[model samples]
Target: MNSSLRSDANTIIERSIQAVLPDEAVRRALSGRKFSGRVLLVAAGKAAWQMASAAAAQLGDGLSAGVVVTKYDHVKGDIPHCTCYEAGHPVPDENSFAATQAALDLVKDAGEGDTVLFLLSGGGSALFEKPLVSGEELQNITGQLLACGADIVEMNTLRKRLSAVKGGRFAQLCAPAKVFAVVLSDILGDPLDMIASGPACPDSSTCAQALAVVEKYHLTLSDAAMECLKQETPKQLDNVETQITGSVRQLCAAAAQVCRQLGYEPVILTDQLCCQAKEAGSFLASIAKTHARPEHPMAFIAGGETVVQLTGKGRGGRNQELALAAAEGIAGMDNAAVFSVGSDGTDGPTDAAGGYVDGSTRAALLAAGLTVHGVLAENDAYHALQKTDGLIVTGPTGTNVNDVALALVR
Candidate 1:
């Protein structure tokens, strides 16, 4: 491919990924549904603002009242009908506690025939934090989990037990009222009860399972948090009608279509990819190396979340770590490039969305006196990739479809 064609392909890929936001997909799904009763909208996530806005636009005067909670930097668009609140992510703050309480209050007194619309997506777990334990205790436990590099599922398992609104508690609150959940899945396989700690779905995980997670990671939780976990159990409700509107499968399918439109052979490896970030990266790198040749121009795509067991106090998200790890496997192989990014446009605690790496990344880092081994050991892929201008920075995309990793061979 020529320079112009290559650039066009890259742009197409990025645009296609961005087009699959949860709000857009949810709007499409709700287009035909009609209800006579008043619609009460309640949503929470990094993409909650966008999702709520789209729903409001579609619902128009049909919406009675609404409330949504999202991350601090993720609020976007306008929804005059719904109240929007911003809160901390990865770790819940006082703002999160207040927002969650308000959301619960909004639905607490719903009449038997009232209709409740619940929009859920990634980062909702942190955006609406109502701890069964004390606020300080929840904060400390959250900090410990982040430091330990627990994956989203494991972290949420523990979060559900120690919260007043997580697991199936939210659904139980809206009992007898007709509840409809519009979800943007961020978990591998789009587990309904895992995303956003399954606020509006049945939680299959038990307190015993949550305890196992804490013990497995050696997480030190405060006495209050531990007691909360031991004492609390989410009430299951069967009246909720849940629907997942967007996920990794949707994003990967869109990406594959774009690649095919650009006249490249597109192959989807998996939409449920999970494991260590580095191991996943190496796996992608191996595929790229095998397919990189003059006669074969191919695009391989995979979607899902990866875990990083943090040993080093470095700044990086799973996508950055995956890119850095793949660099080692694809070293010395020309005509191969790999790009991995979170669909949400924010990876971990850092600002950058993700990172891009190629066969030349290793040499570039070494030239700058950066040791890849040391950086990977400390989970500092962001800094290492930043030195080489490999970080893919896109502010907040206002969408969550897990993470997308692509390998291009030409």
Candidate 2:
């Protein structure tokens, strides 16, 4: 491994995550916003706890009552006047239902002149759900969509129709009251109506589109689920206004800043990087080879989410798969390395944020009886990375802004 380059990558990753934490962003979004009557807070997603804490601190006595529904282990502490519940992510569980019900109950009492301060972030679709279909069916459908490698937009489009709280239905429940939504975008283009299935914003997806996704993916759905998708979601909402706090673009910019500070000439390839996990890694590795002889050290950055098709039952995430796949391409280039991480600090079902791969990674893994193709085919980047000490663990970063992948050539 190139220790210096790895060190630089770690520096960029830590500082970049710090730059996007929702503490300051939430406070900034709440500034100058006027609220009347009762101001209730409903926070959801991986970053919900931190966002709620910062908002509670800012709103103080003004926050009448609040409910926080986040991923399991995300609630770090108590937020006064607010109840926090940790649920599931990537998929919603029974706990998700109960916590979402709490949020709904909190907002259902909103008066005509009241304001519902809805703090939203990525992963909310699963963490903030009130499923219209049976919970079992919802889980099955979600798993199918995931296994089929559906993108965020496609997944959320189908999710919005199946959930009572999504597709602006939550805003409807807070009817006669205004909803001020603070969002942290994890999807490309910052589509307010799509992020986290847009619980507060009116959904832009149509019944046909939802059906199209099911058809395109050849997803098997229950009769009840099919009916739900056939029903159209709310296309417009009058009582909701939105403020986007951060996104992948900011993540890329922050990484670039850190790279420059560390003396690497950074090039932000794109903030809209959307592709298969392995494909992205291979492409980045190819870039490293293309610039193998640069006069100065260089960093290439790509920020956004990637999809992974389930070929095996082994545990891993898109970010981990991305990093591991790059190993082969840069196998003997001692000065090259590639790493990818989810800003949320948890990737897939694993506790790791992501994985890293230096030029020596391929050889080291082979020495340990692990081949990149064999490991990746089982969708088992986590264990393979563990063998090479390549996993990146940064438990519960209290933020979500898609992901960042980097290629360092020194």
Candidate 3:
């Protein structure tokens, strides 16, 4: 393995993550905004704590009662007067329902002339949920959607229909009070109505659209859940303003800058990347194979989340699967390396952030009596990458933008 190349890649990724942190983005988005009367804060999702903390720092005493619900371990410290709660993610638990109810009450009680500042980011769908159906039914449907490889948009479409605060219902609950949201988008294209299931923005999805997603995924839902899916989400929301503060586009650009500094000609392939994890890795390897030169190193960067269809019981996330697939394409090539990371610093249910692999990775696996095809076929990239020291573990990065992939050929 080329240690220098791996180090450079890690550095590039770290810099990329720093560029889109919720604190800086929130601070910039709220600058020059004037507010009247009491300001109530409701922050939700993976970056809720960071976003709320930054806003509290800026608003100080102007900020009144507040509540934050985020993924487990996201809370860094106290946010002055805000009460922070860690909830379940990728799946909702009892805490998810409880915390969401608290947020709903806070918004519902806001009177006229009051300002509701919502700090939203990715993972809100699972992190903040008040289901129209039973919690067990909601969990079952979510698992079915995920196992069948439903994309974020499709999954969220169904979620909006089954949720109380999502799909503009939260904004509706705030009524006469002015609502302003600063969002850190983790969705491709930054669809304002889709991020975090559009809690405070107008939802454009229809009941028919949600039903279509269920049909597309062949999802089996309980009668109650199915009945809820037929209900329309809030289609229009008034007295609400929104600003998209961060996205994968900025994440990719930041990585490109670091690549250039490392003496590589950076090529940003796409920030809208979305596909099967293994297929995306193979595609990136194709790019490296075509452009790699001995004289000039090249860095290919892409950003966006990918889906994993769980066909195997083996443990692995999409990013790890992607890198392991790339290892196959660049097995014998020298100075070719590939790495992918979830901007939130966790991939799937694993503690590892993602995976990294290079030309030497395949041979190393063979020496350890492991084969790429075997590991990937079982969907066990985590263990395979661990054997080659290719796992990238960065616990709870305190932010969530999206997933990023980088291919370096030198």
Question: What's the lDDT for residue 68 in model 3?
Answer: 98
Clashing pairs in 1: none
TM-score per model over all chains: 0.94, 0.99, 0.98
Error of 2 at 25 (Å): 1.3
Q: For model 1, how does the per-residue alpha-carbon lDDT over 279-318 read when each residue is reduced to its tens digit? A: 9898999998777684757888988888888888899988
Question: lDDT: which candidate is best?
Answer: 2
lDDT tens per residue, model 2, 18-67: 99898999999988877768999999988999999999999889999999
Ranking by TM-score: 2, 3, 1
Pairs clashing within candidate 3? none
Q: How many clashes does each candidate structure show, in the order listed?
A: 0, 0, 0
Provide the lowest-lDDT 10-residue window in model 1: 1-10
The 10 consecutive residues of candidate 2 with the worst lDDT sum are 1-10
Please report, in order, the local distance difference test score of every candidate based on alpha carbons.
0.83, 0.93, 0.89
**Candidate 3 lDDT by residue in tens digits, 1-410:** 88998899789878889877888778887888888888999999998998999999998898998999998877889998799999988998899999989988887878889999999999999988999998998998888988888999999999988988899988988888989999989999999889999999888988889988988878888888888888777777778999898899999998898899999999999999999999999998888888767578989998999888887788889999999989988888888999999998888888888999998999999999989888877888998998899999888887888999999999
